[model samples]
Target: MDSNRLVAGITVLARGSQTLGTAPIPNPADRQHPGDGLEGLPQAVPGAVGLCLSGGGSRALSCAMGQLRALRWLGKLDELFVISSVSGGSWANSLFTYLPEHISDDDFLGQPVLDPSQLSLLIGPHRLDHLPPHNLGEVPTRLGLWRDLDAILTLKERHGYANDELWQGLIGEQVFKPYGLWQPDASGHDPRYFTWTRRYLQGQNGILAHNPGLKPGSFLCVERARPFAIFNTALFSNDGPDADLIPFECNFQLGVRHNFPAQPSQQGAIGGGLLDAFAMGGRYLGEANGGGWVSSGRPARPFALNDIAGCSSAAFAQMLEEQYPVLSGLVPRYPYWPVAERAEQDTLHYRFADGGSLENLGLNALLARGLRRLIVCVNTDQAISRDPASGDIVLSDDLPPLFGLQPFQPGLGYLPYSAQQPGQGAARLYRHNQVFARQAFAQLQAGLFAARQAGGAILFRQRLPVLANDWFDVPAQDSVELLWVYNDFVSSWWKALPFDVRAALELESGGNFPRYNTFTQLELSATLVNALAHLSCWCLASDSTLGNQGGLSNAQMLTSMFD
Candidate 1:
């Protein structure tokens, strides 16, 4: 048979199959191919076609072989394509295990795995806000915007399908439209039920359309390789003008409603009181938002061990002298002020009034860990220092400095690219930093193990340094140098410390970090968890720390150390 003629015929059959109602054909034994007259039907259909049968489950592979058989009988056996909805589970199991190992290039039933991009086109566009019922006519209309299977096949013929690019594109698209209707529950709050129902029907349809005289085993191959497509049509709206355009990306208004019994006002209050009584006994402080005593009370004190002033060099030295009287003489010997002077010249600020210091912020702690990993980052300042001699203020570089300094690990530094260049390295570091920050935040919310172990404490502080004069020279006097040292102490400490340290200290001493005046206990807890997870990973990987001498893959390390 001419290959083009065969392909055209197969397309017609496939299109017709799609038009069939959701149910599978009632009688598998009664189906007949168009070109196959009674004698032709038996001969044209491959014997192996009968092997591909849908059993109880609704899966694409169960009926793939049957479709192939039908296509072959129509003389369209050039190429058989299979696309996966997900990378794992039954879908992957069937495809990798059951499909024929090899098929002739010219065969009409050759199986090929489809890239996600191709699958996206096949599934069509999905809008969640206004979901249409699953009627046959509507299915095609919903899928109309997508590149048709025919067009995709043509692209495949020309460019050859590559899974990576297709999958990446699909992932990127989802990043933009997280709640697209194609996702489970795109329409219904519990959409998986509907998805499963649809899959079941499709699988049955394949079995009914199966050819007779094929081995039952062949059905398994079909079931594993047949491509199943789904369309997503979910939509979400935000009232805020500055709300993120990315769907489902923000947590501002997303929620799942629950079904529960309700009682009349007085009765309900009493019932609630009873529940609250039990909760108090069990230490289940009701919902965080509930009008319980814990929820209604003012936020708990911030967690901290040292006075905020202790973060400064002068305070640190004074505290050290007070705690270890013998060290009082040594405090004047070390030039902590030079470091502080550098910091002051660098426009870093020093705080002394309320007890806030850089050493306790959670963001700084995570950054410190990242620095240990040899990852470069830039710190931005909103203001610039004026040059005294030039009588003009100099704007810093547009891009932040690309530098990484390991605080705990003495000297591990890298400058793969110049800070002035702002090239690929800068871009890469920028993206890496952003992703790391976001992941850190997410890890905190998820309450990773390290976080839980730390007793839930975290802190963050912003420093805005404005240089008053261009020629701010390092002072010779020790007191002036001490001021600079204090500034340096805050900046360096802020970058490398983890929030859990403060939380742990707070638990031990019942004290709060002076700087974090408004932070609540819950907020601190969340931050601590995130910081601890990051720090745990850093410690595990550090040669100086645990001393575990195995080089595990990044994913494995993250899972074992943080998960």
Candidate 2:
């Protein structure tokens, strides 16, 4: 588990040979394609910065949009080496990464794309190509209700469908449809089937090729600086030995198809580690063939962004069958050939559920890569307390510890540490919880419940403890600085909003403006979405003091933390 051994696309056997269960003979020419693994992206460094986006359906999506825009405005977006997202946060990640080359910040966050008071401009008849209307005229801005129903029917007919697929389809049509990309289809008009293909990245005249600025190159290359994406999901098995190995009988896994480092046989083996992100799905075979492990899979439809999104957000897919039975396709499953011993036997199918089911914050992926500087944006309604008189969801003075509180909450702070002071089991940094002192936290808490709250976003900075186990190999840094970003409606920006605009938002949310309502609220009104987004943006970008405890804004603190 040495840190140096975690290089991308490398195998324990030799230069090229990779195996699932047993060591295979070395072979140099085993790559599936020229740039099969991590070639399209830069390698992650020990101290690189990573951003984690949490899971909260549409709430996370809107908050992430605002946060990302604010990050871009603060000139920190280009500095991010990795962005790990789960559930709704994955929606924003996919959209942000696939943006057309010409769309600038102004074009992205301006009037046409987002209008705070009006309905969502991204939906309905409005095309995302509005800034200068791109040549992708065939792509519709949004697939209307009936179109989606028809698409679902088609999908159900082809193969049994599920709730996750329906959710992913709607997300694609709404957010990513603007990019105008699709998997090659025979009918050529099936809007539900868009794809994230290698053709879009490395083709002679690919999307990235057409715009050299966004091309994959050196991480230091400012022209191509984009955060490597890691979307997380829980690999589930109700009855298997693997179930015992993982907590809740589910493993916290990532859908990072490229650049994932392979482990030695001492560690749990990953046959062939991970294939190309675009090479997933379809039929495949792995046989001895009297040679090293050789894999054979037909060029069937590969897993797209939507597929990953569906899997990552399938958190409630299993439990909500009684509510939406028609949409409950079998628990999201993926086929694997390496697990099968014989070629005649069927491929082993593994079930996948929501990443949040195992780790809601999406921090595992960044930590797995050994990144030491992290920003975790938690846009969840799960931690709220209700008011007795009103019975409405309200911000509680006692905020449950989201990260870094051991015995009380039992997370990162509770993990056994490898590095510690001579006589101490853990460093003071590892044991510490709140970023603010007791008095300061009390003051901040009071302000949160006051008639006029401070701001909608809250920030907590903690040093994440390095686990003693082999799962992480963060040798360069002793501890990680995790900036916790919470979604709360206590911002000065919220107080300053026009009365009419504020009222409309409150009405949409039934008076508890930023309750972020139910996690199942996948669809939201334009007003509520914009209000939350505006509040989120202001929390990061506004120059005003936050929490009534710190004179600096969240953006300023973020810059100084990285510096």
Indicate which candidate wins on lDDT: 2
Measured on C-alpha atoms, candidate 2 has an lDDT of 0.46
323, model 1: CA deviation in Å?
Answer: 66
Displacement of residue 161 (Cα, Å) in model 1 is: 28
Q: What would the TM-scores of all predictions be? A: 0.15, 0.65
After best superposition, candidate 1 residue 363: deviation in angstroms? 20
Over the stretch 173-277, how does candidate 1's per-residue lDDT look in tens digits? Answer: 221112222231222111111111112313322221222222232111122223222110001112222111110000000100111112231111010011110
Candidate 2 structure, TM-score to reference: 0.65
lDDT, candidate 2, at 146 = 51
lDDT of predicted model 1: 0.19
Cα error, candidate 2, residue 288 (Å):
12
lDDT of residue 413 for candidate 2: 22
TM-score leader:
2
> Where does the lowest 10-residue lDDT sum fall in candidate 2?
244-253
